[model samples]
Target: MKSTLAILAMAISVPSMAIAQTPPPYQPGMGDLMVTIVQPRHLKLGLAGQARNWDYADYAQHELEESLEAVEKHIPKWRNLDIAALMAATVKQPLEAIEKAVKAKNAAAFDASFKQLTDACNACHQSSNLPAIVIKVPDASAFPNQEFRVTRP
Candidate 1:
């Protein structure tokens, strides 16, 4: 009877030990957020602008901005540099320009502003010692399923 009780206690304790040793929730690093959140938004924004889809361009631009904000929020510091400060210094003005272009539905301005934004992105990466992570104006649609072109009803 004592042996059976000891065995049962050990079984219960084993599960408790296993639970205690469980790993913490996964926390995405800066690179993961950039690739997963920022890159796709940037690509979609470029495609929308290229296709002259002003409404979708506006939406994509906002998404890109939010992704950048989230990146700054999630990883406020990277390589000992303030991510928010870096973003403010590099991409803020270009994003504003892009916003203005999107609102105005001016394709030419959108193109120019998007280029400026892409340049700013590259500059930020270069300054952050990530020059190999080059960003550019999307020359082709990476998302084949999404229709970037404006459709008139």
Candidate 2:
């Protein structure tokens, strides 16, 4: 009877033990989430900035920041680029500059900062050895189905 009780106890604990030892969080690979989220948001922000749609630009910038952060947290390493530092050095400044220009309504500064940001994106791609993933100031809206126009409301 004691041996049967011990086996039952072991069986009951096994599932709990497994549950307690959870697996590490699932992290997508580099270039994976960037392509999925970062790149698109970056493009949208640029397009919105160009369109002078400052309201949507704010949201897009936040999303761009989040997307890059997600990449750094989920997939810390890329082919040769240290994503965290690269993001700080290459992407963050122009995003801030753009934010400032958008806030101040400085057309010239906005244009220059936007160009710098696009260049930085391309620079990052080149430095990461993925030059094929070229980024630019979007010329046209790919998301026409969604309104990008700035509304005074």
Candidate 3:
């Protein structure tokens, strides 16, 4: 009877022990999400457009949009400013233009739209009082292992 009680107590305590050992969920800061998620997608989009890789450009653009959406959802406000509103005011239109350009596979349009997007990013930074965070057209590929230029089939 004592052994049965001891076994029952151990079973009940096992779950509590596991719960205590588990770490808290990781909640990344806004800057961390931007650096880890948004920046790479933006770079890839620029590189794809520059290389005239429309398919990759489209994919990159979509990824960027999703990253931005995720950021807005995760951190709706930063420094007391509404991030969603800021994004809508700044990057939203440019992203739409970029999507249209990508769909059309127009290199010229893509270039112009990409410039607009880059400028919008800079503008957002400035408005957010992050004047030092200047974004521009990517002149060099950040991913050395990945080829930006599409090989002709």
Who wins the TM-score comparison?
Answer: 1
Candidates ranked by TM-score, best first?
1, 3, 2
Winner on TM-score (1 vs 2) = 1
**Collision count of model 3:** 0
How well does model 1 score by local distance difference test?
0.93
lDDT of 3: 0.94
Pitting candidate 1 against candidate 3, the one with the higher lDDT is 3
Q: Candidate 2 on 1-153: residue-level lDDT in tens?
A: 999999999999999999889987776677678778987897788778777788788788788878878888876777666888988889899988988988887768878998998899888888888789877778888787877777676
Per-structure clash totals for the candidates: 0, 0, 0
Over 28-93, each residue of candidate 1 has an lDDT whose tens digit, in order, gives 998899899999999999999998898999899999999999999989999888999999999999
lDDT of 3 by residue, 1-153 (tens): 999999999999999999999999999998999899999999999999998998888899999999999999999989989999999999999999999999998989999999999999999999999999998899898899998899865
Q: What's the TM for model 2? A: 0.78
Q: Pairs clashing in candidate 3?
A: none
> Please, what is the TM-score per model?
0.89, 0.78, 0.87
Judging by TM-score, tell me the better candidate of 2 and 3: 3
Give the residue spans of candidate 3 off by over 4 A: 1-14
* Model 2 worst lDDT run, 10 consecutive residues: 74-83
